[model samples]
Target: MPESFHKPVRRPSSMFDTIFGGHDPADTARVAHSTAHALLSRVREDPEAEVVERLVAFTAEHGIDTIASLWSQAPARSLPGALWRIYLLQLMVHEDANTSSIIYERGRHELASADPIVAGAPTPAGPDEMVALADAILRGVFDGDFAVALNRAASFSRVEASGATHLADDYELTEPERSTALTTKALRLSTFAADLDAAAAHWRAGTLT
Candidate 1:
């Protein structure tokens, strides 16, 4: 066969395959990844960003204190970047805290693992889902769901502990600057689940060595 005539093989798309490419979709790792994406999407999004409600109503709801206050002019490290870090970390906590959830985030890192906020890369929050979440929060707030917004705000407050201090009017993480690599504090289980679960699922499927 001519070298130019070779055709590429088509691969099947499973939840794992789509989320963690080259891995078998049936593995637990993928399950974790899927769950992480789904759960985080809910909590991070403004409408469903109920980090506490889900954690409390669901399971293992800790670290709700870490979230930074979005409405506060108290001076955060930076603006949008700070928001991203807090939410991303919360997602990790959510994945890890789940016992039945196969998601694992050890040695492995999630999106906030390496801080490249300056690259201005688009985040899940910037997407339509988050937009909707935010919209829902706004609508709900007017509809007398202030308590709901407050709860979501509470769940991610611990993220502020990640260090988003204000230099001037804008937000900034004064202590540990966000870069390609960030030195995080004692990590929460919710912050490390999805990645670990994805790895385990891959191993379970026997796709990875």
Candidate 2:
């Protein structure tokens, strides 16, 4: 497993305080969903390069927990949920590009699908390329076709899940515990892939929210 996955998630004290300080759950959900839609609208309506860049870099500067707090609880097919998944995917790559690239490489070889192409990753994507690919996918959400971006994320997740499963098999014989952990990770990634793919379909059908 990547060291980044072991790192403790940092939740800002102020945000937790606000969440626990009498803020209603319904109100929080409303704000989260509305804010997600509003942010997407703002970028789509006026997608200046500078504005897109700033939004793309928001989680990098503020930490994933900031947006995770707001949107993590949203329904999987909703706008906020889709946005949260995309940010989470980007964080995974940015935090541990090396492991991501290795797993992706394995999946590229094992999986007999067009996922690698849909994911828009370079052939033999290295750590640096993986990071760039993650950023590009997030940038596409703000500046390019939203459905396409979601599809790309879905494909990426699927490929990684496939890779993780195969790696688990490789470790099953000698390292049972590691194999079990990889299997669990693969299952989680598979779920994310399904949700992201559904979200993409919803977006294309004009019902993402």
Candidate 3:
């Protein structure tokens, strides 16, 4: 498991519960939490609807507010929570980076390791594609294409295990260095999201407010 999602042995409630698990009841980040909970619940409650239906509902009903709200109310100093915030925020902006074809292949391998969802689920873009997409989105921010940042990251074509894929061909990694690539890819995406979040917060605080 990623350290960002560790299970502490000495907490009354899990970090998720304290930070973002159960619904907040106060209507602050409550719906955001509830939607997240419902996402999980639907996975177990009605796994069938958990796929496309739930995603549609989430995008339609709450939009990025539901996502950003989670970040806004996220525990200020929680590293794991911060990582989650970054991941969620990135998930929003990079929605287009669909790497389903590649993921279907890699996910089969990752399922036996860890993070079945991350490994099992599809990515719109592979590592390089995602990073390029992130750069484009960041550039959009500079260009004042406010909505561009909210667009899905980018789509990535399938990569072959024989090492013909973009990342495999462009970046060489030793056998022990494989995980490093995945981690690096995920972090780059997260950093782009965090940067966008920072800029938005700055604008809201400095001017909008």
What TM-scores do the predictions have?
A: 0.21, 0.88, 0.28
The TM-score leader among the candidates is 2
Please, what are the lDDT tens digits per residue for candidate 3 over residues 1-209? 00121222222121112333435535644554455444434454544533534442343344444454454454432222232333443333234334423543453343343232321223443544543443343333223333333222211111122112334434455443654454454444434434434544544454311
lDDT of 3 at 182: 44
Residue 78's lDDT within candidate 3 is 27
What is the C-alpha lDDT profile of model 2 across 1-209, one tens digit per residue? Answer: 22243345554443212222216778778978999999999889989999998877776666766787688777878999889889888877877789889889998899999999999999999998998898899999999999999999999998888998999999999999989877887887788889999999998899888
Local distance difference test, per candidate?
A: 0.29, 0.83, 0.36
Residue pairs with backbone overlap in model 2? none
Candidate 1 regions with alpha-carbon error over 4 angstroms: 1-126, 156-177, 180-209
Q: Candidate 3: global Cα-lDDT?
A: 0.36
Q: Please give the RMSD to the true structure for each candidate, in Å.
A: 21.3, 4.8, 17.3
Candidate 1 is scored at a TM of: 0.21
